[model samples]
Target chain A: MDKGRIFAYLITIIACTLYLLPLYTMVNVSLKSPEDLIWGPVAPARRLYFNSYLQAWEKISEPFFNSIKMTVPATLISTFLGSISGLGFYRAKFKYKDLLLFLIVLGFYVPPQAVLIPLVKFLADIGLYSTIAGLVLTHVAYGMPITTLLFKNYYESIPKEILDSAEVDGASLTTLYRSILLPLSLPGFAVVSIFQFTNIWNEFLFALVLGRGRASQLVTVAIANLKGTTLAAWNVQMAGAVIGAIPVAIFYIFATKLVIKGLMAGAIKG
Target chain B: MARYGNLQIFLFILPATVLVGIFVYAFSAWNVSISLTDWRGLVTSIRFVGLENYLKLINDPIAQKALINTFLLAVTFIPLTMLIGLITAILLCLELKGTSIFRTIFLLPLSFSFVISATMWTWMFSPEQGTINSLLRLLHLDFLCQPWITSTEQSLWCILLVYIWQFSGYVTIIYYSGIRSIPQEHIEAAEIDGASRFNIYRHIIVPQLKGETIGVLTILLFYALRVFDLVYLLTGGGPALSSEVLATYMYRMTFNQNLFAYGASIGTVIFIIALAIMIPFLLLSRRR
Candidate 1:
């Protein structure tokens, strides 16, 4: 009601619109006929149309499944590995432990460009090139640093006394991890798994290079290919993008709190 | 009681250590050696060229353009995103009605993959039928509509716009937390000293966000260095290679042109730049 409050509301409205416009346009065009897209991207659809979605889905279904195949294994492997490594770094006492963790985490920041050349060559040499397995390996390897960081930080907040008592109960290393750390890590698992699933599902670079052809192509690359093959069919192209984004977008919208928690945890720890 | 011996700890860490060592560090070293050669195509042969690729890269016009474009994108993008993010954070930090809704909407773009965002933005920036131009025309602001990604002059800027839209929300979250963490006593004391709301923020609030700014800048600089998906998907580094950054350009050289060694050299350049940006930041953060 007051001046400042009114000013804040006005800016909020404008910023929300700015944020949502492209998404609105994409959805609008995606529901329109090709003839309607020619009219412009801003206009709302005059008639409901599902043909573009159907066509896009039909073309992209294989790669969509491919993404799932790649993403599931990659997410599981990375999260599991990250958990163990995170636990290792947290519980282990040694000289240069901080330095070692620092080195591991530093890999998260390496530009994919820096390693693309050798990665491709190495994959070829090992005969994993152009396979979904290779793509999984690539994501798992790259996923290690961040996941480890996340789990390490997560485990750090657990009381040292809990671990000491678990040891007092005569638990060995494996039993402690199994009986104590693993159970305590369930929530961390939820956060990291969702985080890793969303990321691995949405990743493009490894999918592009390691899995190029139809047999191995990822949804992201498939969508790009759809754009190329359907240059003038804006409606269908938008449909394909929407389809490719559906899984992660759903995660973001429904599990926003978890996503935000993971993001903040990662950023703050970094 | 459950504490592992050093060897057990080593075993626990071995999988990640081996994977990262071979896949990340070892591969990086391999890439460096590849850069020093004249390897090309599907040949097993590699001739050691001893910095020839680097020398050529230093003299290459496209590489120079990429360096300049990358520099310009970073210098412009980081500050603008930070400013917008900071302002948004400040507003949302006010805890006004509907602030949560606005926060959700702002962070929504961060969920969309670069591939998806690039696809959507391509339609938004398409000159003939883009949402932006169409909206402008409908509003009788036809003169305001300009060639966006289609023009070499504007393509990079268009990409920059999309990058900001995608990332500013992330920076906002960081700054929002930073703002929230500022001690309440400081603000109350300032207000009691006859400071206006604006001065209270200017003198006490914004200065404390220095740590947040550094974090944001480091992330943004790294993003700038490794930008490929957006540029490649949105513009393909083109309108005559005008929007090319090192990543896309290196991708084109290696994959498209099959100039393996040449592309590796460019990759090394990017690696060095990343190191240059990251090493100091790491040391600084550690000191803090």
Candidate 2:
């Protein structure tokens, strides 16, 4: 290769390696037996061990199911709400329309720290405190801003003429959404669902606060608690972390373009 | 659509509007009220103190440490991530062989939750058996090894490294898209004008990324303001509260110590800071 090309390749290689190092170490350490862990982390694992994975899975199974129960409903409800709202904002003409949409989307920017104090008390007052249902409500509420924005922006791409023509055909709002917009929005739904699913699944703060204790705890909290409870069981800890991450990692790897598109759409337009 | 009347549209959007309005905005206001009180402990009675908590926070050393540490992390984390991300984006834009693979690898870290990354990083920063130190030892560079997460002076920096690792990929994807959106003709025209590749990039491509820079800055600053998970998980704002950011400090005050009013005050401060950072960016973008 030419010198300039070689230099570019060299830098890219080094950057990629830097990015991959932690992941490599996590996987490597998880596979090492306790006896092999006596050697420093730099050394390759002497043998691949599945014991840690089994133990970690056993430890986190309840929380894993709780995460699923929490995440699925949260993701589905948020995405469904976002879709209808996106269409509503898209099709409906009202005074201060842009301002109203802006205000709604502005919810995306509010830090969780801002709402956390009131959230805990409110959930408790509603008698859902420290429960998986409370966590679901929290995620669904917080997930609104981004999910709505994603759907709004996604709907914006569809030609308004579709709605115009549908209206001309005597189609009502629900009919237009069901018969026209929803059909066109399948891909958008997929992208937004994946985005919401991963976000709600990976969320920690709400899970930590509202879903405290073993019964209601989500997987992220479970993994964190695993880390805290285990002193030197790095293998189990790493294994648990990996297991918690597998679903999102698969989406990230296979649907990278969609993920990037979701990110840019949510970020730049907002 | 004529059928899309105000009520109909409102009904469609009401669920989210009401939820977010109650959960985010209303609760935020509630937090302000709580901050104005002297309600500490698990007491049901709230006695209004009217900015006393804020006033006390001005004199509180722990709060000062947290504010300074937050500023330091923001000042260090954002620019460093953006710079490295920009550089990596530029390199990947070279379209070298296996660039897609590199892109995938680079962006993979963004998928990991803070808990997972923190877990991995804590082990990596273990002073005695950490990955970095072990590598240093293997390479016969003992002098380079230092106390990482265990020391007050370096703990914040260690936390910053993990933050960079987790987020720089996000910045990279944004900047990469930004760079890709730049018209090819501009670079081609510069090339035809006898500009060296370095000069073309330095003068044209890099400078054209101003919008991306701003976007990245706003997002990074947002993360900086809301940083709880990683700091809470990794350092627990420990080593004498050296790595304490406002979020962790607020969390510790409220949950751990039950200083409800004081914690709410800290939350109010975070809320205001988030607004201060966001409004200008919003206005600037709106004008654009």
Candidate 3:
């Protein structure tokens, strides 16, 4: 029994160590000076330099704001659209319901790379390329399927009797959704919000290809550019990474339970 | 009775459906069209090139390398991630104290952007002053040190290691949920029947977790094929395209090399590969 306990502890420690390796490296890199970075491999600096954080801050502030602009609206729009569609699919009898649902889910499998060039061209022709609105619209379209699927599943889990009762009381669709279904499904909304937020925030390829200038560049693109141009500025790059990652990390930490529950809920339903 | 409800449903769903159809499906078709044309550098004067782009792709060395590397990376990543995930899930399911804390710690990586994760890992594998080599020296194992991200032989492996570190936690959570769904009665019955822990796991727990396993495997496989951020950040398919995956190679072809049509051809190939794998799986799961 004692041996088994030790073994379990050992496994846990190893797992935790593996998990922390990248983070540990990031912290170490963030504390080093540019001179140290160029001179050394990836070792700790002679002393911790805090100026890198400032440099990274100045370099990324615009892109950071751009990211926020893109991610927040995208998350809100996607989640709202998803919830409404999910409710529609769940509550109302629709023509070609199965086909519609399948189409929504099919969006999940379409590799973003598969449509990159044409999307770029299409958006460029419409004056949406290199614009924040364009990026948000694209994100919304991409995010809808998963978001809708999540909400639809969650709505399905709600006992049909409650919805029926609301209908019998002459509650209209909007009223019923706002007063009952929405409140009851707040947790699902929170889950979808977090997922969409993380996805939009972390998205790089589209942002890189679409958002060319500093005016619309996202944090991921900023960080990538920073890394490429400021090779010597390891600390600054790490600082940029830390700053770029902080908001999503904080969001996930706060809603970890909700996120896990949401994933399981969606998976089981699917 | 249902007239108002139907109107409401249409109103609620039409916007999202239309957007998805126009952007996703329409764009996908457009992608196919571009792949067939001689479009280059901003889609000007697109001329139908038939299967010329694809035929060129079949013989292109970089594309061949990319196809092979993508398969290799997925092959390495899926099993390794599944193994680590399964182990961690099983361990966590043992009802150990502080499991929640462990879960949180493990999940911390998933919260960070893939760019951040890849950047951090790249720093760790830095040849000169990286923590890995320092730790190795500290433990008197100096011989194992090498330039992890830059070396041809090691670049792909390094990327795979980073992926495993970042994603194993996610799969662990999935498996944990699956394990939790198993009824307690079954385990107790096996225990009462003098079945060993291994026996109960092999016979009961594994069988019960099949659905979750399938789900995780399919998701992981899809993710592996589409992997971009880590490979892009870590090596940029470096050391002479040794680490190039389909996504990265396609990006290079379009943006870096200005081979828009060829890139689209590659993207079309990727779509076909993904559909080839996913369609059967979807059908099978639907049948079940």
Give the 10-residue window scoring lowest on summed lDDT in candidate 2 chain B.
B1-10
What TM-scores do the predictions have? 0.97, 0.97, 0.95
Q: Place model 2 in a CAPRI quality band.
A: medium
- Cα lDDT for residue B207, candidate 2: 89
lDDT of 1: 0.87
Q: How far is A250's C-alpha from truth in model 1 (Å)? A: 1.3
DockQ of 3: 0.60
Model 1: how far is B50 from its true place, Å?
1.3
Candidate 1 per-residue lDDT, tens place, B7-81, comes to 877877887888888878998899999999999998887799999999999999999999999888888888898
lDDT of 3 at A48: 85
- DockQ, per model, reads 0.70, 0.73, 0.60
Chain B TM-scores per candidate, in order, are: 0.96, 0.96, 0.95
Report clash pairs, candidate 3: A41-B128, A41-B129, A42-B129, A43-B129
Candidate 3 runs further than 4 Å off: A33-48, A265-269, B3-5
Ranking by DockQ: 2, 1, 3
Fnat for every candidate: 0.68, 0.72, 0.58
